[model samples]
Target: MSDLWLFSFMDDELREKIKIQSEQTKAVVYSKRTCLRHNFLIATSKSYTENSILAYVDNTEMRSAVKDIQVYHMGTDILVKWQINEVPCKSDTFRVQLLDYKYQQFAETQAKDTSTVLFNNTSPEGIYHVRISWDVYSTVRNLYTHAVGLENVNHGVPAVPHVTDLGNARARVRWTTNPHCTPDLIHVHFREPSSIGLLKVIPGTDETTVITGMKQCIQYAIQLGFSYTTGKEYLSDPAYMTFLSDGTFHNAPKLSFDQNGSLLVQWLLRPGCIVNQTVVTVETNDQPAKEYNVTGDQPLARLNDLEPCAFHTVYVTIQYKNGNVERTNSSEIHSFTKEIGLTKIKTYIVDDVLLAHWESTQNCQALGYRVDLMNPTTGQTKAYLTGEMKYRVSIGECVKSCQLLVSAISVDTMVPVTTLIDVRPERVPAQPRPPFVRRDGPALFVWWTEPNLDLTIQSYKLFVNDSKKMIRDFEVKQPRRSILLNNIEENVVYSLNLRAINESGESQPSLSVQYKWNG
Candidate 1:
């Protein structure tokens, strides 16, 4: 028979041998054995409440203690068996590299009761595996699975675009996003030319990478993609790096200070590459002696008036890989002399909002101003004292004759950004006139001409009196650009009127049209 035997709670020396931390805690006890090969097995009888199984060590020289390794679920009471494979007689390192075996399960009948079964066994191919099964009512388990542990695994693919360029001598070397990227952690690695190459690390989601002062023949490649063609050599490796290209371009961008104190600049970069003003270089437009490095946030090489005509300009060049330099320049935008007198407001209908925009005429270009718009009915302030930035207002309606003011930079020399003024109803258009025609019959439709403007004449309004006691009015959708209002009532005498609508208010009624029922 098997050398192991099963036992239950009794009043032998067992109580003194096993230690329990609490009443609900399990007792752990082990007996030393020095036989050919020996082991310990402890299990529960039925469904035990605080269920736990412990592996006992009898052979002291073996690596056996595993802490907090829970082996069985408390849901079902399981009896587990322990076994020791043939002890390795070699070095400790060879013993530590030991592998695990597997087992299997089958339906086992004890008596009239049918229950579950579990065991450690082997397949026909001799690989180890475990199995678990349950019968009708009574199931027993010799639960010690010899499941084999994993032996092989590997890491994921690395990132992209190893080689890059930044322009006046910089290259934008962009790569793929790290899979381990988090809100605070962006994991990327780079190498420069020395043994370490020119390694630099930048954080955040901005994808394009820039390499500056790149040597002419120094090749650079990154670990990305499966097939990268490096001349005659075919690269099937994803992280292959190479330093050769078919051709190169030297078209550095050209930007100069414009009359508006803005940089008139241009350059060519690889499509989808990004550029940012993290580094800045400045040179004066007329004087070569006036040159220096300007901070990214600071404007202009030096501050002065007049040779400047209101602003300053500094030339900058960005360099890319393949030894190309693209030039773009920095612009110092100065305030303009105000020539703004009358501000023109036009309404544009968009998909979901209304927009009010204006264009500066003559000298108002570099100058700034404030625009105030309010509700006519509520007299509540909407947009007040803003910059000369033109944009569509979130506020949908428009009002007439509002207060607006502007302080000219030519006059004040103090306000760089502008002031207000007041405009009235006389500045806007009169309401549209209603259409007129005597209806000779139902099919006899006549067209009336109206001014082509941005005025609201939603539709035609017709008034008729069938008797002295009852007067009826009909409102129909306005006519198409063709001018005639169609589908009107036949043989009816109509007294027509018109009105214009805006945010301020509707215009007064126009001259009426008298129609006689000739039908």
Candidate 2:
């Protein structure tokens, strides 16, 4: 008792090439397995407002540019808005034949995305939507206003954008501005789902970005059409086929970037349909990724040794003549502050000291080694200036020292280290534990005697009163260290001391401890 077959019906040379009156044409009944057959739209115009007949105009005569819906007009009098997928073979009423550019003959009905933005042209000059066939001739006209109803707005304000800051090659975006859009026309579209076609654009507003890639999974989107202003995206539309990354649906392609923290993604291709031998038709879902001129124009590429702040994603793909391919992705996620200023190197206590940078296991962790010798006696290891830094180390006499080796890169991972500079100097650390006066309560219970540690000791420096303004600190990572100065505003008596560090420096202070809180 269930066969299902209902086409709503509309035929008669497509209803005399429909130029008005679809006789209250309406459709909103789907269950025949959801419906959407080859899609169609024909009736070209209709409006009344004061009582009945609200809107109409149908299109998708189908020619293939992907997202078909071109040049429709209406200053006032026919407000259009279309959406009909398979319903007229006999009666659901859907037909078209609207024209105006001198070929004349206008007014069909049922079509939309907010049609009729303006065009009853009394004189203000502007109104068009020509396209026909069925003895009507004309086929293309465009004017419609309010900037063409903004096409329905968002004109392309960076569509399908998403960027909670994804990293390891790049991806970042946030959008919602494009209605006749200016300040940087837009046209950005990316793909990675049965790929082929559009996949890049941001030449303006730059919108806090980062979209380079090692690839994990992708399919992007953005398209309205832009070519001026700050972000210079060319022009192309199919609603911008979006898929920012993550998981996706298809609103216009929504997958917008996301990957910071443990940073991931390493893509090549995979979705479906790939027959490369019989003539190479490998469209693993549209296309986006696989076009590397390597460095044709080259702006940046080679963050050597990598690992200072960590996090990266770089890409550059360009190909065109007819085959069409354009790409540009770079993601460091911006947060690279390292400009304190001052860099003057001169080392004679050693030979050939060359340190280069540009690595991406997320910025190569600081990049180490610094040596300045001459001044040591003990076991020849009394040290003058030295720093190893991994877990920690910086034996010093202080002529100046900094052992860099930062971190951020994650996937296409990397880590290479070499620290060798022996200006000959070592050993001379071991002298702590002299102050330990406990009085507790009204405050004054300082203690010290901890040293001979093995790395990781961020704090433990307490020098009070002497115009040093009174200081205190502690983060010994471990060990039961102590420091309690409490309510001491008394006819006071303070002069506490203690110093000890093991990341290689600091240790000379532990002989003063005079406590007297005679309130």
Q: Residue 250 of model 1: what lDDT?
A: 41
Whole-model lDDT values for every prediction: 0.37, 0.35
- Model 2 stretches astray by more than 4 angstroms: 1-298, 301-313, 316-488, 491-495, 498-504
Show model 1 residue runs off by greater than 4 Å: 1-265, 269-358, 361-436, 440-482, 490-510, 516-519
Q: Over the stretch 392-418, how does candidate 1's per-residue lDDT look in tens digits?
A: 443333344344323323345523223
Task: Give each model a TM-score.
Answer: 0.24, 0.20
Model 2: residue 87 alpha-carbon error in angstroms: 38
Displacement of residue 192 (Cα, Å) in model 1 is 22
**Among all candidates shown, the one with the greatest TM-score:** 1
